[model samples]
Target: MTTEQSWWRRNRWPVLALAVLLPGTVILTTSSEWFDYQNGLYSHAVTVPDGQSAVYGGAEFRVDDTVLVRGGTEGGDELELDPDMDLIVAVLEVTPGKDLVDSCNLTISATSPAHPEKRTWNANVDLPRKFPPTGDSQTTCSDSQGEPYRLVVAATVPSGAAETSSWVQIEKIGLTPNYLELELSPSAVSSASTSSDISSSSTSAVRRDDLRQKSNATASRLTRTGSTIRSITNPIG
Candidate 1:
């Protein structure tokens, strides 16, 4: 046989093994993702109406309020934002069940025509703007202290973003992928005129104490219209 034929003959077994193993490795690596996609965990959401409560990850959750802050505070250091940006805050009432609340997470996500894919932001704890004192409220699920607690979550959005629709999603822990989606009612609040509108004592409950501790370098002053809020990243595109 020629040199080419001899080489092919010598390597035939190894080539056959590689061909089989390559496809097998790919399938094995992608099986979990494929299963999640097929089960609708990646694309499905059960929309929950506003002011309504639902059980998720062994915890009861309800979006108590939503606010869209526009202006800045009167005195002290103020955070300036891009003209196209605005602040959005959501208050969630959480009552943990047998499961530890720490295992679950809450997030605010929005969908707009400009970006069909969902844009998600965490409950930011390091933003400069201070909200009102959230008497007895917990900023995180883990700090619930086995009692019903309020979760104050805030995120900055593009100006007039998600006017059509936005939601508060509770991340899945040990539960099914069918997660809860609570609709947000974004009402305007100005810290300049009636700063207490977004205060923790009001219906729109939020706290700036813990966040102040985390981001002392930023603005401690709460503005009337808005603040230079945190930018949103990590789109679930």
Candidate 2:
């Protein structure tokens, strides 16, 4: 064979192998990078200390405190809890920034390290009231003119579920998913447990009355301020 033919024959197999392997390697590398980018872009989880503030999706989220109530409330009315279930109430303040927040999208969840399961509950944005006056009424996070509004969210979980290492997750629903993971402080859980146990039985009636009065006052104040307390069709998932 000629010198040119000899050179081609010698290099052809290696060149073919390189052409096949290079494309596959590039495709895999590109796919992995794209997957990572998608994960980072679509959802982000931020860990925040209890009683601190964090910003997500252009909204300011502050978890003021958490309370565990032995009883539950519904539609501004108080209700007795099943002996097995207790209410996990979290008080939050959210400041809207140029975007209208669908209050129904705000949700809370509690997860115990001891227990792998997570318990989640929808938020009652119209607070200190438990629920909206009508089915169509909804609470929204609109521009408050530099004022922050209070949002109280309660989830009924099993007694003794609020323990150390337990955490509460707050989700702000929108195109981009963002979550605030707040560690439940041991002191707060212990205090809530002790107080709830005491108030669960002997003082429940008095507590309900007091809560009702507070709800009424809050509703009146919001109404005077032209705050929105309407309900929407967003269901808790």
Candidate 3:
């Protein structure tokens, strides 16, 4: 082996577990989620560093409106998401160009994707002491209810002394959220496929509502989205 290859082969074992596990987990993450024709996929990427004050950039909601977010907009702002939607992924960037003094303060705010008007989920990144060294802090959303139709993730700095909280000064947020894939019941997607051989007399016996239902289900396409994400952390918890 060449000198470079020989050196790497000898010393690589020290961090080998991390190197192997990292790639396995990443590969597992993609196929773990599915995307279909009826349902749409939505995702975003952001950068918030550890220990540095972050400036929030406004995010556009599916509602066609935009909300502004910055360093001090706390108290957990409310966001409206669309009903009949299924997935939301918030990707954060944790790699800093320079060494960080502390970990990043990552937060997320989410609501039902299927049914709107439901309460939101506000969660934050929990640092495991060896943050920058071990792994990144990300909000990978894995589930959704197709009723609300929107997902909101908010990123913010903790309301404490910069040095006090283990999470502060987020240089970048690496957003990597889970899928909100749909699982349509047979009745929801293929109700008409159930129809069997019938006669003109059967049509006369069928209720008018059944015909109406068939008309509604046939040749149908829907588009639903959620409210604007105000800021990163304030949108969630």
Candidate 3 per-residue lDDT over residues 78-193, each given as its tens digit: 11111112111122222222222222232333222333332332223332121121122223321122121122222222221111111111112332232111111122112222
TM-score for candidate 1, please give it.
0.57
Instruction: Count clashing residue pairs per candidate.
Output: 14, 4, 50
Q: lDDT per residue, candidate 2, 56-156, as tens digits?
A: 55566655444555543231135445556556554456666555555435455565666657665555532222322322112344434555665545555
TM-score of each: 0.57, 0.56, 0.17
Question: What is the alpha-carbon lDDT for the whole of candidate 1?
Answer: 0.55
> Can you tell me which runs of candidate 3 are displaced by over 4 Å?
1-87, 99-101, 110-120, 124-237
lDDT tens digits, residues 50-165, model 1? Answer: 55667665667776556555433221113343345555666666777666657456677886668878887765543435445555556566633677777777666665455556
Judging by TM-score against the true structure, name the best candidate. Answer: 1
User: Which scores better on TM-score, 1 or 2?
Assistant: 1
Residue 192, candidate 1: how far off, in angstroms? 13
Local distance difference test, each candidate = 0.55, 0.49, 0.24
Please rank every candidate by TM-score, starting with the best. Answer: 1, 2, 3
Query: For residue 112, what is the lDDT in candidate 2?
Result: 62
**Which scores higher on lDDT, 2 or 3?**
2
Which residue pairs clash within candidate 2?
137-230, 137-231, 138-230, 138-231
lDDT of 2: 0.49
